[model samples]
Target: MKLAKHIKSALAIAAIGAASSAQALVVDGVTWNPNALNDFSATDAMYESIVSNIGDVVSGYSLVTQLNGTASAVFCPGCELTMTFTGYQLANVTLMADLVTPDQYFFTGGTINIYVDSTPDADFTDPTTYGDGILFLSLAAHTMGNGYTLISSPTPQVGNTGNGTGYLDVVGGSAASNFNTNKYGFAYTGNTAADFLFTSQFQLITNDDGDPVCLSSVNDSPICMQGANTINGNSIPEPMPLALVALGLFGLGLQRRLRRD
Candidate 1:
């Protein structure tokens, strides 16, 4: 009995040590250290995939990273990251008829800004210049919206690409011009109610011009776009280390009681 108790106690100690070593590295709300960008395989893939699959219909798209709270003193505490999706596809399906005859678009170049609130401050717009708490990606011109939206339903469709909601607006132009410059805007809301999960599903609209079309707001339509392809299912932070420590303590206590018996 004494030998068995000793073995159990040793196991418990090992578990405690293992748990401590496996603790995740976190700064602010982000899990991946921006300084060590190359260390995160998933994040690197996400960026590359977005650029490579520009014209392909994006089935699952999500990019999640931590903001650098230490970079700026004005940064909001406990502020969550946000993304917005706006364009013709997100609008009412019926509005498709209103689009140009070719009914195709390509991605050009654009910038996505991360802000603590809906309105971005001037300092937060450019990642290259800002030097902290920013993410920059090379996106094609015609790409619609990218990101995730929380649903009230308890069980979210994990891998379903068309699972969320979107709206529509008019992109008006003559047949010759094709309203090439007009573009739509999708905005993200920072709500820290849950862990951050960025997701998107996109279909490339090929056109004769082969140039990107900018989104122009004309009117609002009901939910149109749905389905997200890539979801950061692992975005949620793990439970506190105390929980593991407690389990270790429980094992130790059990071993002590058995030895006493």
Candidate 2:
């Protein structure tokens, strides 16, 4: 992803096509413009493992791909972000949808536990004080039910990196760059009441590849990110039909599972 970062994601989706699809930036109710990924290409896949969802191990990798031909588009779709790193200080990103819900989430702070599903792995519970609640989703909705896109918060404290979300022990800034945050960088754009959207643009490229410092901020986001590190590009163009049954069931790998091993 570097035609100068696709011209910085095509000028951040052309500022969501000059905004006003109700403050544009959505996926399920469909409004995300970046021409809804016109020229959407593929090759994405990645995998690693340490596993945790508030269990604290927080390091597993999976990057599967699909979203067929015909220039695609779909939105406010929930879950699929798992970031956290060191060196560049990107420290939190978990909007998960591994689907495991039985419903029973509670966390008091230091010694109160009860997690069923939806990105919870800190080995003791503390996803940066757990504030954005849907508790980091595990399919709370929008599996085509037509609702549920997510963008979370709470992971402040950048410079010396002492926020809440990412706290794995890289001792530099593994998970401790803050968690589940995404202030700008990729220059977000999910309005129409955006529920969630990140089909797969897994980020992180700074060793001089440039664009880090917590994504340089539209607000801020960092802490735990993953990518099989495969990338290619181009497009598709379905305005609706539920965005062609939500990316044709993610290009028939059935809600994503083309390859993860």
lDDT of the candidates, in the order given: 0.30, 0.26
TM-scores, all models, native as reference? 0.26, 0.18
Clashes per candidate, residues 3 or more apart or on different chains: 35, 59
Q: What TM-score does prediction 1 earn?
A: 0.26
- lDDT (10s digit) by residue, model 2, range 11-74: 4454444343323333222222334343222222332122123422222223123332221223
Candidate 1: Cα lDDT at 144: 32
* Candidate 2 off by > 4 Å: 1-33, 36-55, 62-64, 67-261
lDDT of 1 by residue, 23-73 (tens): 443433334332332222121111111122222222121222333322222
User: What TM-score does candidate 2 get on C-alpha atoms?
Assistant: 0.18
What C-alpha RMSD separates each model from the true structure?
Answer: 17.5, 21.9
